[model samples]
Target: MVRIAHIADTHLGFRQYNLDEREHDLYNIIDEIAEKILEERVDIVIHSGDLFDSPRPPAQAYYAFKRFLAKISGRVKFFSVLGDHDTPKRRGMPPQKLFDDEIRVLGLTGGDHQVLRLNGRDVLVAGVSHFSRRYREILVEELKKLDVIAASHQVSVIALHQAVDRFFPFEEVFELRLDDLPRNFKYYAMGHLHARTRASFGKGELAYSGSTEIMRSDEISDWEKHGKGFYVVDLSGDKLDVREVNLEGVRPQLEVRIKYDAFDLELKKLVEFLKTYSGRKSPIAHIIVEGKEVDRQRVQQSLNKALLGKVLYFRSRIIEEPEKEFIELKPGDINISALLKEYLRDEKVAEFGYELFKVLKEGDVEEAKKIADEYFRRMMKIDSEKGVS
Candidate 1:
């Protein structure tokens, strides 16, 4: 019987909310996973994609990965593909060279398939790196080629870091439909999306191991539902037996929404919820207020004082209803700067927007343009550095 560990979207070196401790948290979780691998004594580890948060990972990030491999490299074989975040902006330069040959990093520059002989049985592994809408045809062609090769193998698996039509709503124009995949493969291991999912495809099963940690506020709900973990697949039988091994010590996260009229009641409820939390550590809370003309500052200050040290981070998201009953329009009644400030708060870009509005309102067009450019550049840099997006 072949035991394989399927993991993906580790996103190592991700410093969430610009917190250094969060960076350490990522490394800690990886170490735990490595220990689990040793305990399980799996034959192979298949990391679908996203080994590092960025293509050009920081020194600490690289060292963390190296340490992880050192723990289990010789005991077990590891295979991975390049995720969108792991792809370099500069063309023709693949990041696979950074690792030793002990690990087989595929789908970087060209190659897409590898065959491993285990326990007198042949296992074929195929993959494709992140690509845009323009390369859908190329991706389809490659899958067909892999399908032909898989026909001769005992077990065939395909790893990918792309959105599949069955998993998510049809929002992305470049998403891969279920029909695009070849029917011959035994299993499809997926990544990129941060949610645990499993769907049947033709004669095989397609599953996403999901991100190991929470990377964004929107993922909080998904994490709460499925938890964060990797998959354990036993391919010895005719039907695959897949199970999830949830990693322990993941920081908890909570999302709360309160109407303006029920602020006091909701505040009390939140306090009760925190006081009763039985997790190993305090959770990060995202409190969202929804209503018209609510005093966001007053509520936020109250929450901060009440929940101080009780939660790791207390974030406030205030969404106010637009005023639509204005009898007449005044010159400054619809101040663009004021509107921008409110919008920025919702978007969580208040700091940049504040500086931008200051320069634009001062009538310095050149300075405003520079500020705008610098703001976007900084945002992109942050996104790239933390693998957010």
Candidate 2:
């Protein structure tokens, strides 16, 4: 049976919370991932995309991946597609090109497909680099051509670094919808959406193997439940079977919510929980403080004292309910933009703020960047018209 390993969104060099430890954790995971892939004895390895967190990754990120490739270079075949983060904003070569001799990176220069003969059978490994939402037509055109090529192949797998609307709920940033994909490939190895997801599509299944480590606080719950990992696909059977291989040694992250009235009691419980994570690398904590009329200053001081040595670092968010006057409002049509404008007293600024809020709420970092750029451009144009130096 032909075995293929699928992994994506490693985001190497991402230093979450400005911690150097977090940056190196991504590199460490790559080593762990290689060790496991070797143990499984897979014939092929597929890194769907986002091999590095940025197009111009740090030098240490290059060295980390170099060591990883050194371990698996000749033993197995490795293929990767350039992710949105890995695609340069200007004319430049992709970072993966430096390791061209060690691996094949698809869709950057031209041909994104490679037909391989493994275990006396033909297997097609094809993928395209990321395409922004505005340039989706170009991506679709490429996929249409790939579909024709995939028609004759029985064991075919297609990878992409773009987010699909169906799997990725952010409409503003999702580049493609479910129907945008071709119905020919037997396995769809997708990336961009950090959450692991799988659905039966076309003749086989579409799956996102997810990121190797927790990149954000919100991803903590999913990571705890699914445990970060990769997948192994068996193509020699009547229908392909996928097996998930969860990685160990990932740094733990924790979250705790405390009500204002029971702060002391809840703090005690939280401290006990933090005490249990006695590892070389301490866990990161997200503390949520909730209640009406919450004293933000007191809570911050208390948390600092309690968490100083327990966690590597801790960040907190305070949630306060609207004023009692707001609670008495009649049930009627609610307009969030109108309310925001009322509070800001400037229609233009309110609109800009609302747009930013929407993108941040959806966790669409690309869209947030776009909105911020548009906001600044408009401001600069207005300033110029007003003769503001």
Candidate 3:
């Protein structure tokens, strides 16, 4: 049987939250992926796209990828397509080209196909790199051409980095539709989205191996559900067999939502979760705190004191519920003093505002000045008591 390891979206060099550990986490995943692919005894490894996180990757990222290539160079053949991130914004060749001839990246800009003899059976791999939404028409034309070419091959496979409307996360924006794809390939290899998916397409299975590491916070759900890894596609059998291989080396990441009311309880749970992974790997925690009124400064202080050294890093997204400004403006319900008191907890300021409003409306400037002086005096006294200037 012809074995093909379908992987994509390695995203090397991505230092999430600007943490050095995050950058290495991606590199570590590459190492683990290499080991897994070799263990599976695959004949070919096809990275659908995004071999590197950037078109011009960091020096360390290049070295990490080189180490992976060293492991699988002679043992297995490697092929890939360019993801949007791996393509340059201006004029420049991708960083993977540095390993020229070692890695086969297909279709830099257009459709390209190659045939390989595996187990005495001809396996055809053809695809185009990621195309922006603007060049989608050209992308369609290229796929049609590749489809015509696939008609001539016995066991044909098409790899694409574009997101199809069928499986794309967004309902409105899409690069290619399912119908836009050619109807003849034996398997459809897709990339870009970091989610594991499989469907019956064309004459065979359509699948996405998903990203090797957790690239974004939103990907946590899929990463947890499917686990991070690649797919092993066996092509020699009558019915195509696609098996998922999850890696054990992926760094753990957590998304915790701490409500204001349950701050202590949730923080305790989060601390315990981190403790479980002690000496194993520090997990990345993305905390979201929600409440109507919260002291952001105090929240940070409490977290710092409780979760110190417990996690690799903790990023909190504080969302404050907006307070009601006015009571939908009514004629007799205009009690400005009550509204001020509700928001301005300082009773002195609220009283001063009420008195000043009455004096100013009556053109009593001296009385308004007197109320302001008294308000400032009270504020100074309170600030002094709190040890503030």
Candidate 4:
């Protein structure tokens, strides 16, 4: 009865909200997982991908992972693959090879297929790293080869860091379809998606271990609903028995959306929510206000006063509604460009607002700032010519 712990998307070194404590939380959670592994005496640990948040992790992150491996050395074997974040920008360079000889890293620079003879049983593991659209063809070719190798083994598991069809709601970054997967694999251990999920794939099962920490605000609701954890797969029998082992020390996150008119009421409610929070540690709060022309300063001050120390971090996003007065414009009565120019004049950036707007629309904020600087310089020149302060 081989017991394997499946964890993924650790994303160590991710400093969410630029908070160093958040990075520390990641390291602590990994230690907690290691402790659990020791308690269970698991046969192996399988990390799907994203061990680090970036290709070049900070020194602290590297040390944290090194310490984790050291804690579990000689007790359990670790098998891992590289996710998009772990892959180096330089071509043909493998990041996993930097690890100590005690660990085995795969799916980069070949060696994607491993056969472990444990307790007189052959456990086959096939891995594939993250691949972009430009390398989709290469990924397909590798999967075809892996399919042949998996077919020859009795117990085969496929590990990949790519989006599976229908598994995630949005597929804008999807790399492969469900049908692209090879058949007859006993289990499919997946990564890349932060939400925990499980689904049947022909005769086998597919599961995502989910990210260990809350990386984004959008993931807060799902994490609150499903909780965050890893999976323990009991592969002693013909059928896989997967059990979820919830982790402690996960930072709590909350999102409160309210209309502009109800800002005060919602603020009070948020205060009450914080007061009733049962988490051992402070949570992260995101307050989103929607309505016309909110007093951003006043609202932010109130939130801060009410939520001070109740959360590890507090941020507010105010979405101003489009002016109702401008919604009734008649077709062809007013030129769009002319109106924009007038608006820019009112905003006091008329000189370069048009250029800035064009660049901003393309999501180049830095270029937009450069245009604004040039406009400022031109204004300074005009002011000097007129001898004005």
Q: Which number leads on lDDT?
A: 2
Model 4 TM-score?
Answer: 0.80
Model 1 spans with C-alpha error above 4 angstroms = 92-96, 277-279, 321-389
TM-score per model over all chains: 0.80, 0.86, 0.81, 0.80
Model 3 scores worst on lDDT over the 10 consecutive residues at: 323-332
Predicted candidate 1 versus true structure: per-residue lDDT over 288-371, tens digit per residue: 887888997798788988899788787898877564354356433465545665876655466567556654543445556766
Candidate 1 local Cα displacement, residue 259, angstroms: 2.5
Better of 2 and 4 by lDDT: 2
Model 2 is weakest, by summed lDDT over 10 consecutive residues, at 323-332
**Candidate 3, backbone clash total:** 0
List pairs with backbone clashes in candidate 1. Answer: none
Model 2, TM vs. native: 0.86
**Candidate 3: lDDT of 109?**
72
Using lDDT, rank the candidates from best to worst.
Answer: 2, 3, 4, 1
Regions of model 3 farther than 4 Å from truth: 169-172, 322-389
- The lDDT, on a scale of 0 to 1, for candidate 2 is 0.87
**Candidate 1 TM-score versus the reference:** 0.80
Top TM-score model: 2
Residue 283 accuracy (lDDT) in model 1: 82
Candidate 4: segments with Cα more than 4 A from true spot: 92-95, 169-171, 321-389
